[model samples]
Target: MKNLKLKAARAAKDLSQQDLAAAVGVTRQTIGMIEAGNYNPSLQLCIAICKTLGMTLDQLFWEE
Candidate 1:
């Protein structure tokens, strides 16, 4: 199963799902789904998350 290290990283930074959702123009539920690995965001959404986290997609979302 894939994991959302992005969500974990965001939490480490003390960001709420609502906060990330607002920053990425997505719903809080969307962030929740992403965090739960129930949703695979589009490239645009991925980029938005990366930008908000001051990270690159490669840094945030990569298979281990």
Candidate 2:
């Protein structure tokens, strides 16, 4: 499934995929893949993304 919640949260923070990726030490394509559900990030990467987005793991990564 698509990670629309992550996309929306990123948008709400005015963060482009590049910006969020740089903040989390990944490539923009990595971020895109995550939102596209083509990649399952490592726990460390997930935590980094959550921190950069000011969100919890559940708020961003949970399927619900």
Candidate 3:
């Protein structure tokens, strides 16, 4: 499924995919793939994203 929660959180923070990717030490394409549900990041990457976004794993990655 598409990660709308993650997308919303990124937008709420006023971050583009490139910005968030830089903060989390990944490429913009990686961020795009995550949002597009074409890639599943590692736990470490997931935690890095959460920390950068000021969100918990559940808030962004957990399926409803």
Candidate 4:
């Protein structure tokens, strides 16, 4: 498992975890877990997150 890049991007956009969770239709705890690398979301959830954040899945989850 790897760390999510969400925290940095969200901070850059001035979005709180709760704000992102609401945008992606998930719980704040879910976002927290994702950020903490404690949860792996389904493809649909991943897509939702990427879409809401104006990023690609690779940008958020993949490492070189």
Give every collision pair in model 2: none
For each candidate, the alpha-carbon lDDT, in order, equals 0.86, 0.96, 0.97, 0.88
| Pairs of residues at least 3 apart in sequence or in different chains that clash in candidate 4 | none
Candidate 4 C-alpha lDDT tens digits along 1-64: 5454888888878999999999989999999999898998999999998888888989998877
How well is each residue in 1-64 modelled by candidate 3, as lDDT tens digits?
8999999999999999999999999999999999999999999999999999999999999997
Off by over 4 Å in 2: none
Tell me the deviation in Å of residue 44 in model 1: 0.5
- Per-residue lDDT of candidate 2, residues 1-64 (tens digit): 8999999999999999999999999999999999999999999999999999999999999985
Residue pairs that clash (backbone atoms under 3 angstroms), model 3? none
Query: Who is ahead in lDDT, 2 or 4?
Result: 2
Model 4 TM-score relative to the real fold: 0.90
Which 10 successive residues of model 1 have the least lDDT summed? Answer: 1-10
Better of 1 and 2 by TM-score: 2
- Residue-level error in angstroms, candidate 1, position 45: 0.4
Arrange candidates, best TM-score first.
3, 2, 4, 1
For candidate 1, the per-residue lDDT at 59 reads 83
- Displacement of residue 15 (Cα, Å) in model 2 is 0.4
Q: Report the Cα lDDT for candidate 2.
A: 0.96
